[model samples]
Target: MERIELPGFQDLRVQFDYDEDTGRIQYRKLSNKARRASSEAGHVADVGGALYRVVAVEYPSGKSRQVYAHRVIWKLMTAQEPPREIDHINGNTQDNRWANMRDGSGGANSKNRAMPKNNTSGACGVVWDKATGFWVARMGLGGVQRTLGYFENKEDAARAARSERLKNGFTERHGLPKSGLDKPQTLEDTLV
Candidate 1:
């Protein structure tokens, strides 16, 4: 999804500020601070495995609420609430850096997913075609599967699959190669 700058963050009290360059959000105070000066921002924090700089802000009512540091920064940076799903471009969920965050779609996010736990093929979009006796090259783009082709050599198939993924704007790191299964085995090695 395309990124846009929203304009509702100003509605909230000036208790937090975000630095897009550094991807840091300074929280003026904790939720329990009891309406302290907004000038005193809190330090970076890790809440529930994600980096957060908690802030005490009024939301829904007069009472202040403790919000996620990333969401707070997102609001401050974009002046809007982020989409329901946010993408951490670098694959580091805790890296709430502004450049690392973007409005995310399921298709785009899935394209950045780590290789499946049960992946036997070392390449991203290659699988052995048992019926055809050839390595098949295919790509999944925007939920649509496009067959690249079949090849006798696994390396060639892997190259074809990787190319198809790139042509569709998939990240280079998407479905990164995991094991060494992509390398061709020698006949002698197989005999043992």
Candidate 2:
């Protein structure tokens, strides 16, 4: 069992608890008023409608430091079922509102990203080589590199690449064509 140190009500007091089931530390609040302690400890408490946890420490020279009570409480409350992965919808770590949090697999987590402007090549920005009968996609984030594969046609390769991007929460932006600019001219364009 592991114990977690949480902030206490006042001074350098702290609380401790263990998560026997997962071998993790658990910290909760105490009802009694805190007493001054030599070292820092953590504890949990309720604030408004939310639960919070904190840790406090005092140096030998009598200087003291205190942290908020929300740290441990948020983890324990939200991780009860523990999703494979947790996503913060707005991408903010501190915005732990229940509605802002979602449980999802790694793949699902990736599908929610906004595509970069320069990433124009495969499903998100990939193109297939009709001459070689190979599917190719490129990533421009750090450097340009080709992700290639063999496919029957450009569409097959494009779909596969798009599926991969979608799983990681990456969505195409600015109405970019999913299959790139090489798509065959449609009759609608001729009429226009």
Candidate 3:
């Protein structure tokens, strides 16, 4: 995949201190007047059911743009632009720890997603087919949706879906419950 270039990335590096290990970004000495130096730099954005950290960075040209915090950390840690999609290894979107992230393709990232809240069969790709009176298993591989098969038993369908996912390099953590570290208890806890 091609790397995504960020305008004024160098200036952003100068204005923030990114802790690669902890996945925290703090405002540096040249940060905006409203924020104090060494303070935490972003806000949490809940998209779908996932929480991502986003920061509004002001460039030298005086234009402010919002960027994903995980992408910024990837650039800082790798010293190169990151891929368009960043995947969380543990299926917890809010856990930005360096070890839990990877430069992911759309297919690979989709394979690592948490189970949907609306899932009725209690599995990632197994669903009840009302018309057929059978449990159906499906998978998305390399951007193509493929039907594994239909089964009379729900568990059999779920097993088929899981087997296909594993064969296609899906993580074991995928389809598990989604969770993350506790939110900051106080304003000071948000600081570096």
Candidate 4:
């Protein structure tokens, strides 16, 4: 079978009426031969919740294609493909609302992530260095992990980590939350 170029913003414009507020793509009016029209025109027949992909049928050939909703929505709104990843600001995969999405690098996207549930330390990047018996704070900058500072207290270490994260341009949401602040698991956890 021949490969087809992926449908882009201009291509989708003919088949979808995008609602940026809700991130929904509704089927638009089409003539009898339009592929998308094989279903219905009034509302997008298959669109449900925030699905990651949609099957779009071309107007003439009736060719069906799979497109990522977030990418398509970003293209429609911004008129360009994302520079890297399409990240959801609130950490919700299904919430593709226009404001929730942005173009970002892997490092930048990681900075917006919530602290992992498995993290025993209250800080996003701070870990108890058992060998040194100090609360070590570190952060990722431009894909490299850099040590921020070492502190005697977990709070101090967490603060240092937060400060470094902010100074490096990471959003506050990506910083450590309260739960990790005092979760010292090792001997160093108590040393702080």
Candidate 5:
């Protein structure tokens, strides 16, 4: 399929009214074979397993193009094209509030992600090294994976991974469980 070029800020503003505070977009008027006046725009769709708000815009040539509502809001509110990547501050993909969205690099975005479902341990990058009988701490930065260290305890390994992540600019929310709480998991925390 051909990639559709995003319409300009002015072009989008003409078609829809964006609410920055709520991250909602509404149609200003009835368009050819599409939304009615003041109707909500966009529908929730799965984008890489996370749900995101997206809208299909009909072009002059009778072709429809889909765009992320966050990107559309960024353009309409800032009068600039959205960055190549945008991070949802709280890690909620559907929350498009102005305060919750920011431009980010691929690495920064990755660092802000929630712990993967496949992770057996409760922490990110702390895994069991069966052969060595140690908890291995590792991390990836800029497409390069590096081992932090090995620990006798999982919490120690988790702490090491967390420390390396912080030192390397990972978000505090990175590796957090789906509950979104920063639970006490490190041995240092218990000691304190």
Candidate 6:
């Protein structure tokens, strides 16, 4: 319930003139001291203890249009806490709303998750290689990549991956089994 000063509103690129008679702000092509260029597009105002960035501008001609800067402001105002990092829950940047947004750590925020499907590569899997000298696992989403790491062995690497997922509460799909590699999957493997 602390009031914070809104930033980046004083210097705007697009010019808007305030109408005293109407008591409403309007866009004007001319620039003046009272009518400085808007650091953002469309219009912005505070409402119900929250600031809302106008998504569209209604021109004198009565045409409505979407503005990017206004949308950015809306997100800034509505975010939980300046959004340490903004995550698009559905993976679309344009869908910026309170429900679709989440605050995340920079590392967690960069996960490039795609729609889950049966044949999705690496969905329920972790990298395993005994002879490669190091073990590595990675997950990607939205052009962002995150790596688990370089373990001494495949088993060690898998354990590390599973531990990380569990700590983060990520559901396990096809990683290592909980019992470790103590029990072989097949009778032949056990005999060997």
Score each candidate by Cα lDDT. 0.62, 0.42, 0.71, 0.63, 0.78, 0.41
Clashes of each: 1, 31, 0, 2, 0, 8
Q: How close is candidate 3 to the true structure, as a TM-score?
A: 0.80
Q: Report the C-alpha lDDT of model 4 over 130-180, residue by residue, as the tens digit.
A: 989999898878768798888887888887787777787777667544344
For candidate 2, lDDT tens digit of each residue in 1-192?
Answer: 123343333322234343333223323344335633332235454544333444543434555455442334334444343444555444433344555556645544444333344543424546656687666643332234446456665565555555454443454321133233234434232111
lDDT of 1 at 21: 74
Two-way lDDT contest, 4 vs 6, winner:
4
What is the Cα-based lDDT of residue 141 in candidate 3? Answer: 75
lDDT of 6 at 156: 52
Tell me the deviation in Å of residue 192 in model 3: 41
Candidate number with the higher TM-score (1 or 5): 5
* Model 3 lDDT tens row, 154-182: 77777788777878888765564443222
TM per prediction: 0.65, 0.30, 0.80, 0.67, 0.86, 0.32
RMSD of 4: 7.9
Evaluate residue 149 in candidate 4 and report its C-alpha lDDT on the 0 to 100 scale: 84
lDDT of 1 by residue, 139-175 (tens): 8776678889999988888778776776777765566
4 or 6, which is superior by TM-score?
4
Find the candidate with the highest lDDT and give its number: 5
Task: Choose the strongest candidate by TM-score.
Answer: 5
By summed lDDT, the worst window of 10 consecutive residues in model 3 runs over: 183-192
Instruction: Count clashing pairs, candidate 1.
Output: 1
Q: Candidate 1: worst 10 consecutive residues by lDDT?
A: 183-192
Model 5 per-residue lDDT tens digits across residues 1-192: 123456776677777887778877876647545676556786889877888888776566767688888877877778876787889988888888899898875666887888888988777898889999999999989889899998898988888898888898888778877665345344354211
lDDT of 1 at 135: 90
Instruction: Give candidate 4's TM-score.
Output: 0.67
lDDT of 3 at 171: 71
